[model samples]
Target: MAKISLRPLDDRVVVQPQEAEEMTAGGIVLPDAAREKPLRGTIVAVGPGKMLDSGNRGELTVAVGDTVIYGRYGGSDIEVDGKEMKILRESDILAKVL
Candidate 1:
């Protein structure tokens, strides 16, 4: 894989969408229309931590290259360098994907 990466501006982070989880029930393969949309993604790039007014660092809990599960209603969808991605503040991240 190419190691190309972009730094997110300000307090934003970049995430690449992950494939949907497998469905195993009655030995049936689900159709695309029947599958739930994936709400988790792989971290690709991240910005420097959000800065503080006091000239101190506001640490971001997540870093680049982590798998994360995010809220479906959060984030602004985007395409960075022709790859689909989400741009959101670190606070918008819900949890790390196990």
Candidate 2:
């Protein structure tokens, strides 16, 4: 994949969402409108850590190339270089796939 040009500020990150499943477990093909939004993605770009009151930047646990699960309704969806991506705050990310 081509590299994304966006740089998120603070505790935000850029994620390339995984495509929604095209078929059901029962072998039924799903139409676009019937497919659920994907809740998992791979991190592409990460922002600098959020500033802290102690005159130091707080460290972020996640990093680029991490596969993470996020909330279904979290983050802003955008298109970068004709590719769909999500920009989410660090808080929006739920868990990292080990």
Best by TM-score: 2
lDDT of each: 0.77, 0.95
lDDT of 1 at 91: 76
TM-score of each: 0.77, 0.96
| Candidate 2: C-alpha RMSD after superposition | 0.8
Q: lDDT tens digits, residues 1-98, model 2?
A: 56788999999999999999999999999999999999999999999989989978888899999999999999999999999999999999999999
Q: Pick the lDDT winner.
A: 2
Give the least accurate 10-residue stretch of model 2, judged by summed lDDT: 1-10
Off by over 4 Å in 1: 1-5, 21-24
Clashes of each: 0, 0
Give the per-residue lDDT of model 1 (tens digit) for 22-90.
Answer: 665776777788777678888787888777899976777787788888888778887766777887778
Q: Candidate 1, residue 13: CA error in Å?
A: 1.0
